[model samples]
Target: MNSRKQVASSFTSATQIPISKEILETPVVTTIVSSSDEEEEMSFEADLWVSLTKTGKQKTPNMIRNDLQKYIDECKENGTSSQAKIVKSLAVDNDSFRKFMNPKNYPDQWSATKNETYWAATKLLEKVKHEKKSTKVATVSSARSKRKTSDSPCISQKKTKSELRSDLKALIARVHAVPNVAQNGGVYDSCTEVVAKIKKFLNRDGMTKALFLEAVLGGVNPHILAKFLAGKKQDQCETIVYRTAYVFFEKLRILEGRKKSKARNINEERYPQGFSLTKK
Candidate 1:
């Protein structure tokens, strides 16, 4: 009997366990629910607070929240964000202003101006104006100084006649001393004597020695005698003295070649015939 009783108790316990498992796995329709209870609780709390505030004559948090949102939307529509407005207002054609607009390139606190955009434009314009003015002033001053130097009388003054005559005599003496001239059968000596005689003759003709030397040196070719007369008639005695020296040197070279036993190739062909005594 006791064994039957124990068997019956075991069967009852096993059946009860399975029934409890089925009930947990497949809940009853009345026991199951959607998960919106927390949301509904929050909404009820918000409504209750709004009603209490209205009765107490206090502003509702939702009203304040909506107003603040409306204000933000209006500001965005009007392009009124501080940084955005500044960038727009400071819009300029200048490269510097463009660089300044780049946050990574520009300093955070550039100046005390409340509007950074307008400040940059004004500052750059002023700087460019000042630079142009400075450049103009510098150019004008440089031109004025250059003109002054060019027009100065001292810069254009020529050597005096006496100084020129002295220089010519010295040059002739140097030419005579050259070894080539000495070997040319005293041809250079004759040239020097001719020049001296011409100077004397001109002096006798009431021409100052300085004026005579100047005309000769200025391309008269005193050695030709005819050119010398022409130069004197033309009042170009300085040119005569100058051109005569060239002819004298050329003749000296020819004479030197004749004196050389081997007939030295002096290459006088390189010199233009009459050009040797012509003015530059």
Candidate 2:
């Protein structure tokens, strides 16, 4: 038994790998950042820009006016407000905006500026915000109705600190278990696949969009993440994953507060009975 123990210990010691400077300085796999309900998930502003650009060509004054009109109509149809006021705010007046929109009516001095293009896009985004709010309210209402129908309370019972800690640890482990960024080429292969994956894992285990956003804002810069996610270059996708993962890991550390708690515990232990033992 002694010989066997010695042999096992020796073998373990012999196989132990030394930690490299690179390994210590940088992490490979990090905690996964997840978002809350798909409806509540915040899209990168860059993604919004891409969508806006794809809507139509904004080079001409007419095109910009047309897009603005479409958005205004959409907002009004969706129970927003008066389009005239909105248009007047964007340009000088509703008639003036229309005149600029018409190729024949367009004045020689009234050239479409970058500011006009931006304003039109901004109005479109405002419409989108209204739609998103409506969707969120509907989703919450539906969920509540379903719970009431099933005779179950909509609110869940509170969990104990230990239970919360255990759950968090399990979630962290699950995050680590996901395939590495380098694997599967990092970027999503297809729209369908990405959507399905998000549905399956995004809000799972108390991982909410709020938490994801906090991590994004707290660690990896949100603007950088947005740029990478919105970019056309395929190579940038991996970078997004790495930055997101690193930030997520940092967020987990913050949420767990393990170090702070551990230190407190140590202090309590050393100062038991409210007395600190001083060296003689």
Best model per TM-score: 2
Total backbone collisions, model 2: 2
Mind giving the per-residue lDDT tens digits that candidate 1 earns over 1-280?
2322342234334444546543332222211111222222111111011111322322222333333335436658777654344334435344543444344552322211122332333322333444566679979998997787788856654567777667656555554555543221211212222443454345432345444445434433335454444342123333434345544554434544534211111112222221222232
Model 2 deviation from native, Cα RMSD in Å: 23.7
TM-score: model 1 vs. ground truth = 0.19
User: What residue runs in model 2 are displaced by over 4 Å at the alpha carbon?
Assistant: 1-130, 133-150, 153-169, 183-242, 245-280
The clash number for model 1 is 22
Q: How much is 266 displaced in model 1, in angstroms?
A: 9.1
| Stretch of 10 with least lDDT, candidate 1 | 42-51
